[model samples]
Target: MIVSEQYGELRGRAFAIAYRMLGSVGEAEDVVQEAFLRMHQTLRGGEPIASPRAYVATLVTRLAIDQLRSARARRERYVGEWLPEPLVTGPTPAERAELADSLSLAFLVLLESLSPRQRAAFLLREVFDYPYREVAEFVGTDVDSARHLVARARTRLRDRRPRYHASREHREELARSFFAAAGQGDLRTLEALLAQDVALHADGGGKVPALGRPVTGRERVARTIAAGMTAMARFGVRLEPAEVNGEPGAMAYDARDRLVGVLGLGLADGRIRTIHSIANPDKLRHLGEVSDLGLRARAGERPGRET
Candidate 1:
């Protein structure tokens, strides 16, 4: 009965904020629902929120900051290579690119290094384009402190952030090639597609077998990927291509069709630069039921051996 157009406009934006901050879709949804509920309750009580957007955003920001504080502890105990839960996008891959990749696995991993306040400040000021004055108010700090928070976050992320390639078409082609090459255990093709300094990161979260450290350099990454494909083949797992976090990606499902892993790549200069694979069962839980029988069938046309 309390539905309003304003709430509709705010819903996606609020979810975006929460998702970017927490790097977990479930937590972001919960925070948004809770924030909306609180805001709705106040409205029902006849309170006047002059600036609903700012009021709601402030609430979401504070709540997300608190959640990050608590979640950080859990992450520390998490098993091998903790990657952000991948966000498998929808039908419109082209439209989802910019917004989707903003939540890219690499970016989220960088945010994890920041303190709660710094993360909140960085997201608010940079990602959301919030003014320092308002960002200060949201984080319960002065304008100067808010600026410092954002600066600190940038400093930490400067060297870590992925250099996103601009050509979406080229990147997609590169990703598909890498996926196919790795699946077919085509090391030569994989080597050609991957940069000499390519890095492979797998986040199994201690729940499954994954690399504890990043596999760096072209040769090591190529072999590691080949080995993974072999394992997937041995276990009868199949991969389906889809838009992941606004870019090309593959989802691997087990023999029972249970979602096992999601792979997203960072491409640059027409080469696969970074491979972020999330095989943590918990992380894949948000992907729901995915069947890629069609993609599996289409693979027959590609000139590569079965994985």
Candidate 2:
């Protein structure tokens, strides 16, 4: 019964906040739905809202903070490294690199180091460009306290935050070459494109085979990626170029065209600094039909290679 011209834009913004705060697409979607439902109820009750945008944002942010707190324990117990659900954005026009960097898996993983309220305050102030007063109101803190929260978050992420300096076209071309070299198992070319301290992170979530810990250093990471690509080839998996979280990346599909995984890259100093491979079926479901990777793993199936 609640219909408005601003509903679409509001919903998009609400999802963006929830997704950044929680780093889970499904949970963010649920939070947005619930937040809007509450909005409908409030309006139906004849409650006059001064600013629907601010109200919805506050609802979504607080709800996401609560969700993050409850999810902390589960993440602590999660098998292998827990990576954010990949947001496979395909070929969207380049926005501000700063904004794009904030959505990277590397940045999201670094945010995991912060406490829930700190994370919320930092994202609201830094990424979403919210004022301290509004951030305080959303997170239920004073203005000074909100500033303190954001400052502390900045301190914690100071060393680990990702920086981007490459042009969008360069990033895309580099990513294409990087993925191509990896697919061909070209170790030399792969190493040439990677930073000396580059790291490869794979999240299988205990559903399929994956590296238990991050593979670091150019030599090690390159070898790991080359080997993994070989294994994927044996199982008829192919990589399709994509833009994951606003950065150049790729998606893995099985021979039957079911999405099996997503790969995202982090670039700094004109070189790939981080490689994020998300293969968890649960995480891939939102993108499209998810391949039953677990079943294949259990059955030890290795079909013929495909182009």
Candidate 3:
């Protein structure tokens, strides 16, 4: 069927849009499936659809905006700091470099600060490269309004937007050094690799033990990583290099080789600027067999020790 063929071609792009908009893999996949179902129904019902691709995009965008609006309340009440579900992109430096600017965890976290419509307009125009008129149509606004939405979104995000100043090889090297230092609890090396104002964010969803607030400043961030890594290493935890959210990251595995968490680092000025760790079992279920960090915490296996 023509619809089937179109679904095959458009599914990836549609999922990308939804994932970027909703920041949840399961929800994004649902949005894409629902969009295609509607498209299939419309086609079967003898409705004239000009372009299946555009129709699907519109459906996905609208669905994702609604989903995001509803998800905001839940996130506001979420336990600990909320971070996007880690998107494991594999360990490919070139691909990671290519996608870091738009697909990184930090970028998605920044997008979370915008209202649903503003997010939609900003993403449609800035990330997806849609025309102002098309963005307006997608978000149900005039071209001028769409432009204003994007401009406002840009202004809001200007201060914290991710900007990569390192090459692919440099990023790879920095990740290696940073993780190596942390794994070894080498505080001096970690401090050297971190930015002066670096911040570390972790999300546990109250299902595990994680920092309730970001640890800012190079010294504090490095110290936190050093102590946590030392404690985790005692439990036979190992950090396996991986790409997360299109950025250099690692997956932590427990003694039994079960996934304990995922870490995504955001680089700026050739230093590690942001560190995102997702240890919530609910969030790690998609990546692999998630370890029971909460149970472990209750059993006296907690991360970090007084230094």
Candidate 4:
């Protein structure tokens, strides 16, 4: 097939692979674009690619791996905590349901614990179903090394899997109950729905005064969320259900329809285990305007509540 046709077939898959590896949609898109650009240049210069699709995917993956190395250094210097950029595309309801677990904030956070090679190996193997040899080629590593990386990543991830294993329905239900309880200032309901060791971690990028430290204990998290909602109410901020990192979550918007913050929930055993509220101005760039969600809404929707 022609390079153009080959790119068309592989672009979406490549983008998906890069995005999962980097956890940054913008960066992933850039990596894919650059890969194609390189391919175009090579073809125009009369260099033959054995397989255009595979070549481009390999280019994108290598670029993403390098970028991840640099990003890790930058994140190490980041003020306070850092979180993945939430995917807020206006997807269909069905797409939202299908992508929720793959794009959940908690899942992405867990991925951060892996090294760049480990992440590339895991996503290529688990998400893309690339064989060990194919994954090794894409990542520019030997098959044995690739296998080891995937195994190590899996071991680390297995330890945390239980914390985020709730079904989509159960997670959404927990998110809804937590939000309603906070909105209504019902401390008892909040306490009942939250795990005793629940924690609240906010990433405001040091630009806003978020919880610089994790707020541990269910009562502490409840009080903190309640206080936050009360303060927002004082500032005329309204909370709405929104798709955050493919999971059921809330977003805070001002009277003018500008996104002010995002709320990400963590569930365990059908109870809220963690609440991540991101209000940093710098982090809101990708979120655009908060509007009526379709699949994205259902992706983050808490059931048992009136629209």
Q: What would the TM-score be for candidate 4 when compared with the true structure?
A: 0.85
lDDT leader: 2
Any residue pairs clashing in model 3, and if so which?
Answer: none
- What is model 2's C-alpha RMSD? 1.9
Off by over 4 Å in 1: 1-3, 91-97, 290-307
lDDT of candidate 1 at residue 250, scale 0 to 100:
88
Give lDDT tens digits, candidate 3, residues 125-150. Answer: 88888899788877777999999999
Query: Of the candidates shown, which would achieve the greatest TM-score relative to the real structure?
Result: 2
Cα distance off (Å), candidate 3, residue 194: 0.6
* Candidate-wise lDDT, in order: 0.80, 0.89, 0.87, 0.77
Give the candidates in order of TM-score, highest first.
Answer: 2, 3, 1, 4
> After best superposition, candidate 4 residue 225: deviation in angstroms?
0.8
Q: Which of 2 and 4 is ahead in lDDT?
A: 2
Q: Output the lDDT of residue 46, model 2.
A: 91
| Residue-wise C-alpha lDDT for candidate 4, range 1-307, written one tens digit per residue | 3646655778978787788888777888889999888888998899988887689879988999999999999899988888776665455767665365566677777899999989999988876688999899998989999999999999999857434557666777788888898988999999999989887888877666577778899888888888878766765678888767666788887666877788877677778776777776666777776432222232554322223
lDDT for each residue of candidate 2 in 1-307, tens digit (9 for 90 to 100) = 3357689889988998898888999999999999999988998999988898899999999999999999999999999999999997753455556556788889989999999999999999999899999999999989999999999999999978998888888998999899889988899999999999999999999888888999999999999999888888878788989889988889998988999899999999889999999998999999999887545764677665444
In candidate 3 the C-alpha lDDT for residue 253 amounts to 88
Candidate 4: misplaced stretches above 4 Å? 1-9, 89-98, 162-169, 289-307
Please identify model 2 stretches exceeding 4 Å from their true place: 1-3, 90-98, 304-307
**Against the true structure, candidate 4 has what lDDT?**
0.77
